[model samples]
Target: MAATPAWPPRSAPRLFVAGPLVQDAQVTIEGGQAHYLSKVMRVAPGDAVILCDDETGEWAGEVNSAGKRDVVLTLRERLRAREAVPDFWLCAALLKKPNFDLVLEKATELGVAMIQPLITRRCVADKLNAERAATIVTEAAEQCARTALPQVAAPVKLETLLRDWPESRALFFADETGGETAAAQFAAHSGPAALLVGPEGGFDEEERALIRAHPMARAITLGPRILRGETASIGATALWMAVSGDW
Candidate 1:
């Protein structure tokens, strides 16, 4: 008799569901997820899969029912508990669709706790498709084997973000004008923090003043050479992960 393949295939699919999960429970996966499993992956009853509720860690389950529009799986065991993600947020000014999408993907891989889209005066893409962004992050987390999904908030104006900034969270502003190196800035501070990256055209003078005046803001320079909006966001996140987060 052949041994059962690992409950979750070596390449486990990352799923986002709403709930508090329990062992030996039944879960019904529907919509695009169902279509992917049934038609794309051709998963059948008894096939193993991994499930995550974004609350209760990762679980190993087997397909109990498979249909065109819906698939049901019964929880067999807990594969791993939810991981503790870094207390870091990427508050970036909206970029063009491509760049913004890249930020969302990489941010998830970097283990950011949240992704806050900021709309500055110079921002190129003020409107964001939340559903698509969520999908991108979900796929990214799955590929990177991340247990927790980073929360993606809707795009808000820069002023609003600064006005409502949480006092306890440090805001590392990547100021293109001038400031300390990112490494030095990160080394000097610790605890829940956020890195704010400006848009493509960069922040206007008025926007810059608002950011600089924010009590929680700390200006940090990426380097002498200017980096693209997406590059700055990813680079800052990577630095923070290495210096402060779980690398």
Candidate 2:
């Protein structure tokens, strides 16, 4: 007899649903998700799809219904439990569209818990498309095989972020001017932390002072050369994961 196929096919498509999911239940994929699976992926009935809810784990499901605008799936089994991501938040000043998109895509792949976009004096992109941003992260998580989607918060001012900052979580601010090296600093603090990356022109004098004075903040240097906004966010997150998170 032939061996049974893996519950979740190796090449099964992965998607992020909104809430809790259970085995032997039906789920629907609408809008862009539907378009991608039916049109782009060309999935048909019997083709497996891996479904993940941010609140729960992963499920092995097969396409039950497919349409031009919608596709329905029925869960066959639970594949894996929800993964424990690092307790890291990427609080970055907003850059231009292309650069900010890069940060969202890369940070999701790096497995950050949250993505907080901060509006500073030098921020060129004050407004963000929340729906589009969410799509970017969701797709990134699906592509990277991440079970949980990173929380993409609405844009907030730097001052507000500082004022309402959690006292327990450490905040690592990437300061080009002066601070300890990222490796040493991250190694020193392994608890819940957030990395703050400035915008294209960097933070202004006032903003820097406010961040430095914040009780939960720790100023750190990326390296000798000044990196771009997106680079700083990705590099700092990767370093933190290596030093303090699962490597």
Candidate 3:
């Protein structure tokens, strides 16, 4: 008897597709994705490629044809269902371009449900390139094999965020000045929660007062050493996941 190879080999390249995936359905891969598969991976007919539709789940796929401009795939079988992300959100103050990009990438990898970019008085940047930010997070999710993508919202003013925040969700404010320990606060609240991180120079006195006065806000500190805006966002998100999320 001859041994058969695994259905989808471990070396298969995973990707997130747009449309819903159904068994025996054909999916067209174009643009950069086509280049990666045809030119980079050099996947020929019958090669396996894993596909994930954010709505459905993960699916095993087989490359049907390959061309310079497009690669067609046939959906084989359902591998896994869409991942259920935690109810946590990262409300991060906008930092420099590179720094904010880092925040978006790591937040997606950490599996936060949503990313809310905040515009604070000390923020270096008041706007975010939504398309660029989406691409960054999408790539990060694809690399991490995430079946679900985090919702990224446009940058909003700090006061507006505080004002519109849901009362049911606990907001853990990462105040540079001081407050309760992050890990402890996160462990104490296992319900729907969020973390608010300040910008480069940290939040101003008035902004700090506003956040502190908000009923849903609970001031928390990362540690003795001060961290940059991106660091705080990433670190606090990871911590919350470990403590209260599906870690």
Candidate 4:
């Protein structure tokens, strides 16, 4: 006889629910998730629904009931364990709203462990909508099939960021003017690391000097071209993942 196919097909809708997902446990999904199941996907009883608890990895579940306001499913088995993401963080300077949204989305897809929004003198925006940002990252993770969600931190001033920097992590500073090659520097480092990129107007002279003077800061350059704020963050992150991360 042929081997049985997977219980939940890859086409099944995936969601990240709160709390732990145990075997044969009932999971009640509400709000927009319910709408997505009942009204959108029209999931029926026994239909597979992939779920991640953000704590216990991914699980395969079957719909027990679908109501207008809620959908309940019984988890059958754990599909996979929580992924091991690279020990990389993106300490990016605040950019325009749309640009920053792209940053959050791509950063999540790129598997950043944490995102620290920086407030600099040249930053166009100093504040971040925490709820909205969280939603963007969650959606991005769902789309990318990432079981582990990156932590989104509140916006912090550059001075405070530098002051509270971890002693062991290497801070790769993407300086527009010039520095060591990014790919080379990333390949050389082996421990916890972070990338710091500037805003639209780039870092001010004082800010640049301060970052460069930090003991953990290793100035790096993307390439010959000077990338835009969003481009720099996204591109540099991709490059880092390919070089030093779990690509």
Candidate 5:
């Protein structure tokens, strides 16, 4: 006899629910999610929905009932455990709205553990819409099939971040002025680490001095080409993931 196929097909719609996906438990989704299921996906009863509760992990569920304003799902089995996100953080200076938005999306897809938006003297934007940023990351996680979601922190000034820096995490500063090789430095460190990139105008002289003087700060070089703020951040993150992240 032929073996049975998977319950939630590969093409099944996936979502990240609000955690604690207990076995055999039913969940009720509402608001935007409810609208998405009913109106957008048109998910009916007995439809398979792959769910990922950031806390519990991936699960295969079936839509038990669908209503105009709510959709109840019954979880059948856990598909996979929550991902083992490496101890990595991206302390990126805020760029223009569109550019920073790209950073959030790609950073989530690239598997960074946390995102710390920074404000520098050269920054064009000092504030971040936390709610909008969260949505972008969540959607990116869903698209990339990420089991874990990176925390989107409130925007802070560069100096504030440095002052509260944790000793255990190595800080890799993307110095346009240049220092150690990028990949080489990443390969040298393990455990908790962070990559800090500058804004459109790049880090100011004083800012650079402060960062470089920090005991935890190690300068990184992205070859000879000076990339735009968003490019540098995303590119460097990808390199870090390849060299030191969960590649």
Candidate 6:
């Protein structure tokens, strides 16, 4: 006889449900999720879908029923434990909405533990729709097969962020004017760390001085060329992960 399809097939579609998955538990997929499974994926009973609760890690689930508006699933066995993401945060200065959204999405995929949005002098935007921002980050995590979702904190002013900076966490500020090299600094540091990126026009002189004066802030340069807000944010994060994170 042929092998039993390897429990949940590797090709099975994956989803993150609000779950505390237990063996033999049932989950009813509703709203857009249901629509996607039924209408888009066209999953039928007995087909498999990988499910992650963000708390219980990955699980094997079999479709029980594919209704018009909902899809029911039965959890079988645990496939893997929740991912161990590094304690890395991306505290980036806010850019325009679209650019910010791109940073949020990419940060999730790049395995940031959290996103702390900062309001700087040259920032184009001041506020974030919390729910919408969470949705974007969640979708990015799910699409990229990240078991843990990155927390997208609301935007805070640059001064407030600096004032409340955690002493235990190293704040690697991506200063356009430059200080220490990015790779060297990342290699030298360990434990809870965050990368601070500037906005479109870059931080004003006063803001830079304030950040520089902060005890936890370590000024780091990307390169000779000045990069845009989103580019700097993502590029700095990728470099950090390569050196200090679980790359």
Summing lDDT over every window of 10 consecutive residues in candidate 2, give the lowest-scoring window.
Answer: 5-14
Per-residue alpha-carbon lDDT of candidate 2 for residues 133-217, written as tens digits (9 for 90 to 100) = 9999999999998998899999999989998999999999999898988899899886789999999999989889999999998
**Over 4 Å off, model 1:** 1-6
Model 5 score (lDDT): 0.92
Give the winner by lDDT: 2 or 3. Answer: 3
Candidate 2 runs further than 4 Å off? 1-5
Instruction: Give all TM-scores, in the order shown.
Output: 0.93, 0.94, 0.97, 0.97, 0.96, 0.97
Ten residues in sequence with the least summed lDDT for candidate 4: 238-247
Steric clash count of candidate 1: 0
Instruction: Report how far residue 126 has shifted in candidate 6, in Å.
Output: 0.6
Clashing pairs in 3: none
lDDT of 1 at 48: 84
lDDT of 3 by residue, 73-147 (tens): 999899989999999999999999999999999999999999999998888889999999989998899899899
Each candidate's lDDT (Cα)? 0.89, 0.91, 0.92, 0.94, 0.92, 0.90
Expressed as tens digits, the lDDT of each residue in 45-108 for candidate 5 is 9998889989989998899998998999999999899999878899999999999999999999
**Residue range with the least summed lDDT across 10 consecutive positions in model 1:** 6-15
lDDT of 6 by residue, 34-99 (tens): 998899889999999989888989888999999998999999889889999989999998888899
lDDT of residue 93 for candidate 5: 93
Q: Pick the candidate with the highest lDDT.
A: 4
